[model samples]
Target chain A: MCNERQEQDPGKFRDQIRQGKWQKSTSGACPGYVQANLVILPREFALDFTIFCLRNPQPCPIIEILDPGNPIVQEAAPDADIRTDIPKYCIFKDSKLVEERTEITNLWRDDLVTYLIGCSYTFEEALVRGGVPVKNYLQQKDPGVYISSVMCRSAGVFWGPMVVTMRPIPGHLVARTVQITSRFPKAHGAPVHIGNGEPIGITHLEKVDFGEPPVIDRGDVPVFWGCGVTPQLAAMKSKVPFMITHKPCHMFITDIKIEEMAIS
Target chain B: MCNERQEQDPGKFRDQIRQGKWQKSTSGACPGYVQANLVILPREFALDFTIFCLRNPQPCPIIEILDPGNPIVQEAAPDADIRTDIPKYCIFKDSKLVEERTEITNLWRDDLVTYLIGCSYTFEEALVRGGVPVKNYLQQKDPGVYISSVMCRSAGVFWGPMVVTMRPIPGHLVARTVQITSRFPKAHGAPVHIGNGEPIGITHLEKVDFGEPPVIDRGDVPVFWGCGVTPQLAAMKSKVPFMITHKPCHMFITDIKIEEMAIS
Candidate 1:
């Protein structure tokens, strides 16, 4: 009943995650299937967070959202369990990571709301398919992420700067890369800032705020795309005492294709 | 302070609505302007509504969403006031129409969240421009609407059959019409049902749940697109004590161009 058997196939991944055998990062599971960035917050903060995502769509293109207190991601995965399906979980208490568990069966509450934001990995697949060279995409490394100075439109108790992931596309193919990824608005569609890293207030390229340091060649242009770190940062700023997120790289893979999210 | 300029201009129409003038239905205010469907609910119901929109995107493509209790719609109109800007408003109490006002200034609440969903008017303009004759578009009549038995995906307390708007396309131009309208995801994107009316559980063509009767022809095929009414229908079903929406034929016009909504 482990997720290992379900790894290659998304349908079986649902079964394995349901059976509690797949307590592993879903990074390599279901290669073509869309993996979602999850954030489950209580009712008290649900409205502000939903507004936050709707306002700042680039960093938070919501793939699917579940009803308040509903464990089943009805649209993303009809029978999938949000509390136990995510391979790993990050629980935050008033902006602090208080626990890291394999499942949130004990933490489930009646007013909790789940948001499944689109991951950049979905578009990373597009950049490769468009014939652009994505180094981290090929090596299976998380793109370098940073807490940028780009502020998100605030909603009620939620407010934070836009978190962006850095990927160095060469100057020649930068336009092509942009054209390709622009089609997937749900997956951080296009590059927010193209060239100047310092303008977005990135002090240093070599030192990343999150993920591994990106590779930059002589002609490589450092392109930044919105990251899943956005809602994480927003939740931390609001300091919602009861908030849970998927562990980095440990996502909730849905039974949807990446192209299904491409502006459709 | 009347909307004195060209009726087809969005900016001019918005300018008039903002200055405490032109508070009538926005149906004929701006001919080609993309009118939006408004939904204002308390924070308690926002996450569920947002989830409902995400699940049923065809019926609810979002234009811009304002934060809970926030009066400003920054992206759609940075200086626009949500409470007084729209021409007409409908107040709902326990799913019943309690009041119809020009402004909600007296009802301004700290817990209210505003959502602006895309309207069919965006694509109706595209269709008209493409030489596909839209009788309603020319006659200044309301687009035909109906509440079909086809159930929309539910979220929390929101659940109901989708309300669809019918457009009769000549047999030969049906495919072309679909291709053109398909470009605007912000405007409901594409048709869900075509050719047959009863399959989606519609019994009569003229006895619509809302709006005018379609002018179906001998060589025409009835095409159905998800209407913003679906969300309102869902909200009414929730029986929430308090909810606010735009009056029939009344909508909020955005500064964004209709062409800007077209997908490449």
Candidate 2:
């Protein structure tokens, strides 16, 4: 793949996606860079949904919003096109998953507004660098994602349960784990619940809604962070006609340093 | 008149306001507690206006937004009747200022939605305690508010220039001033500009547009923060057929503390 070259950048990665040269997930493709979850809606629904994100910040941390009728994520990655940058895209109509496309270039429209939400990639890097092992990265597997019973603060048409990603951490390293993750505010900040899954309305860790199920040993605790899937869940609940999102790990990569978000 | 003795306890303060015996500014009344700038609009305009506030953080940092047709501020202060608790309110009809009433109980409609915006009162108190006194407070006056060249990040039905409140400080204390104010993120955190006023399009400090003219001492610097007034101006610019805001200093005071906002 052309992505095997060191010179591969967002522009190159985007071009690869456009040319059908890359049809794989975007994780680990560009190290030390930022990735975002996409949410595109009609101009009418965009305002209320964006407000819902801003109101409940820990869950829906913004990356950059595209101007109405503009598909380019001008601020996140000016050189890249939102329609073709990602390896895959999900198209939703009336909040139901309609189709998964390799390229959304055909569906792009002037009335559509795009939103880039911060992904958990930055904090996962921070957790690993702090001498704590993330089994998801170590085993090259997806972290467990679950739909929790915690209802999000609603605004206008957007309202739904909070979706969280869980990572099993050894009890001894859990304190240090939260302290490190706490530094990156844009990347879901810190764990909402450290040891207790029942309190946050997660009945069983083994049966998650998305990604692979986590392996919990004797002394390990399941740590949950607010996930980017939150906005998707809300969008789904609203059943807004004609919505689009980045499929699975096919995230849009940005040039911002993750450490720039580490402020007290 | 009752405010002098009412300052001794929260019981008397709430009692008087509830009884309609008192209608005064809530600034110094609720010392450590957070105060909010209120904007009440009908259901028809709620979505668009809410989105506008979300897109523009500096001018319209929202503390809480009630659900459609919900008059009570359940988050900020539960059981608080917003229609009458506030000392004063301005009613706008079809984009024209109509009435400045003490209590909006008569105007309350089933379709009204309320937005509690973060007031500068919280941060200004912190600034005073930190030895960086806001000039207007010392002179026993209101803040120096101006309609600036800076435009708000627009949302549907809400698009206008940002209005800023200026606080003049000594050139050397500028950095310390920012550090002090940054802590209160809920209350319009940090200054937007620290230098010349001309760049932000403020032609004359003497001929002030909104509040008191800033008293610029020798060697002092003029610093500007995104004022809550910006959202008000933007809302006014939209000329929504129906709307309401607390008149000037007569704000909605709550039990929330500014320091309590530092969740991280």
Best by DockQ: 1
Model 2 misses residue B257 by how many Å? 2.2
Residue-wise C-alpha lDDT for candidate 2, range B1-264, written one tens digit per residue: 224566534444655777887687776776777888999888777766765775676678778877767787677777788887888889888778898988888788888888899888888878888888677766657778898998777766788998888888888788888887776666877788888899999878777788777888999888888888777777788878888999988888776766776444
Per-residue lDDT for A120 in model 1? 81
Chain B TM-scores across candidates: 0.94, 0.94
Provide the lDDT at B69 for model 2: 75
TM-score, cand. 1 vs. native: 0.90
DockQ of each: 0.61, 0.28
Per-residue alpha-carbon lDDT of model 1 for A1-264, expressed as tens digits? 223346577767766766777776665678767888999998878777887887788899888777777788676667788887887899999899999998889889998888899898778877888899899878778788998988988877889999999999889899898888888888888889998788888989888888999988899999999898898898898878888999988888888887776653
Residue B123 Cα positional deviation in candidate 2, in Å, after optimal superposition: 1.2
**Model 2: TM-score for chain B:** 0.94
Docking class of 1: medium
